[model samples]
Target: MIHFNQVSVVYADARTPALDGVDLTVPEGELCLLVGPSGAGKSTLLGAVSGLVPHFTGGTLHGTVTVDGRDTRTHRPRELADLVGTVGQDPLAHFVTDTVEDELAYGMESLGIAPDTMRRRVEETLDLLGLADLRHRPLSTLSGGQQQRVAIGSVLTPHPKVLVLDEPTSALDPAAAEEVLSVLQRLVHDLGTTVLLAEHRLERVVQYADTVVLLPGRGRPPVIGSPAEVMAVSPVHPPVVGLGRAAGWSPLPLSVRDARRRASELRARLVGEPPASRAAEAAEPVAEPVATVTSLGVLRGTVPALDGVTLGLSRGEVVALMGRNGAGKSTLLRTLVGLHKPTSGRVTVGGVVPHRTPATELTRRVGLVPQDPRDLLYATTVRGECANADVDAGAAPGTCRDLVLRLLPGIDDDVHPRDLSEGQRLVLALAVVLTARPPLLLLDEPTRGLDYAAKARLVTVVRELAEQGHTTVLATHDVELAAELADRVVILADGEVVADGPTADVVTSSPAFAPQVAKVLHPQPWLTVHQVERALGAAS
Candidate 1:
């Protein structure tokens, strides 16, 4: 469906091509998973297919790149609109209509499709993507995952033959992501539509991919082939892939089922040295009160957003704040950070009232990374952004340079923070806040746009910070991320804490928010795949 032959793309100001003499062909109806570290140019490659690179983005192009045998350079995005449909990271940013059903029909109306036909397509899409129940809901009322699905449905209603998605599930919960991926699968297997996606959550899609395209770092060659073939040798492997590598298994397994099947046979075939004994079942860390809210309550307009809710974060702990959208999670975080002063009850951070302290003083001890990376970044260069953030940290000039380099080694110092990819900018903004070494850290959807490696980096960074006695709080819809990284899992429902306990105790109790692994391994207290791998046979 798409072919690139010695295709190199260079922005007018760029010193080098974003894609370097790349050569590859994607067969019709193939679901190709594009995987790589940040700034590996996944967006650049996808833009090439949709005529956004050299055409919309104003870049110099060389060699041949074609979509459905039509030259990309000649066919701009509008020209290729009917040929391909794209869904990006921020679905709300792209939405033009107010309601779900209308949003789905927007694309069809643009293509001059008849009203009757458009209605039928919208109905089919509603059922296919499981949005029939939500057909009348306002787009603003939907959750992050539901909004992203609406974005996909909006594009699919036009019945485009080629679908291009860039990090479609980065902002959704695991269940939401599964819905989007299932839609993509049906589009390919049932409808014979070709699918090309750039995503960070490999666990959701890698096992089913017909082709995998791994872009080499900025200056290297692109590796493209079957899932097992490319992943077997890739230096940057997913955790499960890493497990296969450590286990010395041939024909690397991408999913746990495959791993289990192979491990059972390998147990008999080999008497290799047992891997180092895994960590013992860790005792639950004592929860200390870092920031406590006693009898806290707040009202939005007339409705109470939070009511008599008592919440606390402990020193040296990762607490995952789980809830439905508009369930008061954001309100609680904002209130804690002094953005929204609580109407009642005492809120304390490090035993000091955040509301009573000066804003500058509060920021010094507390770091809050917001949901939209755009909100935090307002500087011309990545370095400049970090420098501005540093003025509060009382650090010498250029202090953020080393700090950013430490946390985000993949980011170049010169690029504008806004110009980087969604995931890149997110991680960069996060690195800026960490420069302060705040005693208490607050993050909202920290892993939204980050890739697998980036997610792993954030997990490690948070773990290290907690071990150093800094309190960490994360507001996320990603249950899997919560299960893996959180020491204490707190579920928020309608603005009050509905459930609270150790990660194993809370997440393992609810199927709605539990990690997929919990379904297979019952009676397992471990919340992470890494923990499971390290403690293999310890339970047996």
Candidate 2:
């Protein structure tokens, strides 16, 4: 259904081609998964399928790309609208309407479909994506994950033969991610729709793929194979794969069920060795709470975003704030940064009320990297953003730049911030916030676009910050990150706190929240590959 004939793409000023000699064919009615590190050509390749490559991005396409017998070079995105549907990394950029229902119908309306057909498809999409209850909500009022589902539903309503999605489930919770993937699986199996998606969270989608395409960056040619074949050698993989590698499994497991089946002997080896006690180490006495929320209640246009939520953050601790979409996790983070004032109770950071404090004064004590990294970036070039961050944070001249290089190496200083990939843009935003070295830091979906290596660098940076007496609160759906980095996990539901405890106690107990490693080594209290590796090493 999709064919790439010796295709290569090079941006106007790019020194190297984004994609080089990428010759491959995706069979009809199959789900193809794209995997690679950041700066890879995954996004560029996806754009090529929908005719947005050279047409809209101003790149030079060296070869041919055809979708469903239509050449992308000749048929622009608008001309191929009926044959292809695309949902990019950022959902905010895809909406043409203010509300969910209107947004879903906009694509079909643009295609000149009959009103009755459009309405039927719209209703069907809302139900399929669990967006029926949110049909009336404004796009701006919805949560990040909610907006993502709406974006996907909009594309699905068009009923295109091919769907191209980039990080489609990055913002969704575990259950929501499963539902979205299941819908895609149904589209592939029942409707004969061809699905091609690039996701950094391999743990969520690897098992769902019918084929795997690995775009190893740094000018290496792409590798195509089955999920197991690709994951065995792919540098970027989920913790389950990492665990499988550590334990010398003959055939690496893509899903937790498969891994659990092969974990009997390894579990026996870990009989007496408990997982390393990160929670116990973090329980040592610490400084007073850098941020405090007492019965915090917040309303977003008549909806209770946060209700009667009381929490405390001690200095030098990392807390993972987790829950389903629209569960008030983002609201709590925003409340800490003073973006939203409490409708009822109080919020304080470093002894000062965040909402009452001046913007300049508040930034020194608390900084927030929002879900949309573009919100914090305004400068034209990467260097300019770093310079501005230094000025705003009153830090050393090279502090922010150094952080960016550490988080993602080899980023061009002169490149426009708009030209960077989603993961690259997120790294810049995080560097900008880290320059302040605030007593308390808040991150909303910090690992949204980051690959395994970049995420590892981030884990290191955050841990180093904790050692210096800084508090970090991450509102995220990345279960693996919580397992690997967080000292504590706090879960919220319906604007109220539901679960709050150590990471092992919180994540290992819930099937929906457990990481790949924990699920494989269940009943043993292991949360990460590193934990299992340590236990094995000690036993040996």
Candidate 3:
């Protein structure tokens, strides 16, 4: 249903094209997955399908792109509204209305659909995406994950023949991601809708794809094949695929069920060898408490975001706050950073109350890299942003820039912040916060836009910080990251703590939070590909 004819896109004053020599066709009723590292033109290609690339982005389109017999060059996004629906990387930018129900109906209203038909689709989309309870909530008041669902539901309500989504499940929790993917699966299977999506979180959607498109950046052409075929050669892949390669399995597995079927022999090989103790690596004398929360409670409007949450963060511990979407993870992070005033109870960082501390005083005790990295960035260029961070934190010159280099090397100093890829922007924001050198650092969904390589670098950086006696608390849905980086995993639900313990104990005991490695080699205590590889190496 979608065809790209020798497509190459180049922006003004660019030395290379964002996409080059891409020629492919996506059949109708199929879910096509786009995979690659950051800056791989995945977003550019998705934008081209909805005519937002050359049309809205002000780029030169060298070749033709057709969707459902309508050429993108000839038909703008508005012209193809009935045939195509698109949700970009940033969910906040996609909303046109203030409320959830209104936003869902806005697209159909624009298309001049009858009121009755629009209402029916709105209800169906809300139910399909598990947004029925949030139907009347204000867009700004909802959590990041909730806003993402509303953004998706808005597009789905139009009943477009084609859906173009960039990082559709990036903001969603595991179960919520599954629900969104299942909705797309149903659309492709039952309704014959074409789905072309680009997501950095391959573990969530790689198993659902009917076809895979790999876009190697730097003007390289795209490679198209089946999911297994592409993942076999793709540099970026999910943990399950990484495990398959490590185990030398024929026909790499894309899902947990498939991986488990072939894991018996490997499991026997490492029968007695326990997985590496990630928590033990950080073993030390119980350090002083860096932050303490005493029966914290926060209310957003009338909704209880956090309720009676008591927690303690040590000076050198890396803790991961995890749970379902709207489980008060972000709210707790905000409370620690002093962004939200507790409705009841108290929060303290380094002996000072966070909510009551001055903004300048709070920076020394704690820093937060929020879900949207752009909130911490204001300067036009990367260099300027770093310089501004240095001044704001009262740090020496080049402090922030050096941290950025450590996190994401080879980034151009002159590149505009707006021009940076989503992953780059997120890394830059992290560097900006790290410049403060706070005793406690909080990261909300740190791996939202990061590929595996970037995420690995992040893991290393966070580990280094923990070694230096800094406390790190990351509220995330990326279970793999928690397994690899978190010394302890704290699960929250309904504004309260549900589970808290060592990474292995909390994750392995819970099926929903287990990583692919843990799931594949179940009844065994393994959480990551590195852990399994280490066990195999020792046995040999």
Candidate 4:
């Protein structure tokens, strides 16, 4: 029961409309997925539903957006609070209270609901999102995934008729993501809530979508249809869709199980050909360790975030740190950059303890791109940010700008850093970190908002850095990226290293960690669609 009639949104000084002449309708009780490349007006469309587009964002709206018989043009976000709930990409920006339980009840309290009713809804939401155990925990102390759940719960407690989420599962681990999606499914089935969401990790949510909306960038009209119909022509898609296209499968499958059911003959055709080995190319003689952790232990509010974890990174090595939510992946990266002091054991970067080194000295030797790219960005314009980055890293003026162009071509130099899309912001942050030419680079969730084209650019830049004798360690939940770029995979669980080995060994052996290509071509050892395409091309 959401309708956009001839909707067009243009920011104050933007040359083109973020959304142009868009007409879309989401029927009641249906979950519609908005899919597109970065900067495709997906976030703008979501904002329109909750009355945040022109109202809070200071933009001009050309047409009316109505939700449940209420025109967003007439009702502000606060007026539509009972009928709409919106969660933006950054969850930390949404929280008003410090603790999980208080955040969940805050919305209902604002709505002036009875205290008893608010309490009942709070308990129900806590159980629905699996946040019962973390009810008392401070929001700042929780993991990214945990904070995401709390953000969602705070909105869900209002029992709104519509839920609009931007990348709801982006920060969640596989299992946690599944739980969140399952909750949405229940809401659509039992509660008759209208759910509209945008997610880059299409593999996790495409199969569950009732309708798919494709917004080709550059002010193109939106395409609306079933998942298969849209994915057949969509430029950005998951590995399963790519595999389906490569093999000429009719009606592309959306999930791994569907692809596996149709993969028998294709697997047979590639029987004798093995995928090319990325690990072999990366197996050069190991140089001196760039960073070393010996029995590292870190405590977060009495919880052991990292427990006796020992790891090493050699010069020119590219390692990926992977694990479930709250499994110590982010903690390890922070430890290397000296953000978290180890409660026990020691960490040394460039042969000196990271915690003991001065901030300026440590930044020269090691640069970190945090999970939230906004942490590294504060300047108003893109050019200003790059200039500041050059000054901070002691590099030439144009060094950071050149890297930004390489990572994301055609980005406007005069645009505000906050106005850029999530992916573009990430690319800018990466460029800022790379300006110093640090011996070691750390990226946490680097590809969270990137499209396929942008991700390919990142892959090339990361590989080039390794070739120049730089050590790179990235913490990620994107399995497909790790499969394509990582020389080695290190998995942590329960604050300890559970598995550490070559990329092939670590990813293919675990079902949860395997990419879509590996899942479809199991026992064949192929990890990426590109690898399989290359092998088949060579054999033919």
Give a tens-digit lDDT track for model 1, residues 1-540: 999999887765555567898898988888998988877888888888888887766778788889898898788799999999988777888799999999999999999999999989999999877789879888876656678888988999998889989887776665666777888888899988999898777767787789999986676889999999999877656556765765577888888677666555434432342323111222233467778899998776555778888877767777898876556776788788887677888898877888788887888778888777788888898878878877867777877777566655756667787668887787877877887889888898887766666777788788778777887889897776786688787887777889987777788888777664554344444345565555454533
List clashing residue pairs in candidate 3: none
Per-model lDDT:
0.77, 0.93, 0.91, 0.91
**lDDT string, candidate 4, 1-540, tens digits:** 999999999998787899999999999999999999888889999999999988999889999999999999999998999999999888999999999999999999999999999999999998888899989999998888788889999999989999999999888877788899999999999999999999989989999999999999788999999999999989988999999888889989899999999999889989988888885655552668899999999998799999999998999898999998889999899989898888999999998888888998899789999888999899999999999999988788899999999888878899998999888899999999999889999999898878777888999988888988898998988898899999999999989999999899999999999998999989888899988787778878
Q: How close is candidate 3 to the true structure, as a TM-score?
A: 0.98
Candidate 2: TM-score?
Answer: 0.98
Tell me the number of clashing residue pairs for each predicted model: 0, 0, 0, 0
> What is the per-residue lDDT of model 2 for residues 47-84, given as tens digits with 9 covering 90 to 100?
99999998999989988999999999999999999999
Against the true structure, candidate 1 reaches a TM-score of 0.87
Q: What lDDT does candidate 1 reach at residue 493?
A: 76
Model 4 lDDT at residue 455 = 89
Using TM-score as the measure, name the better of candidate 1 and candidate 3. 3
Native-to-model Cα distance after best TM-score fit, residue 67 in candidate 3, in Å:
1.0
**How close to the true structure is residue 145 of candidate 2, measured as C-alpha lDDT?**
99
Residue 246: error of model 4 in Å? 1.1
Off by over 4 Å in 4: 281-285
Model number with the top lDDT? 2
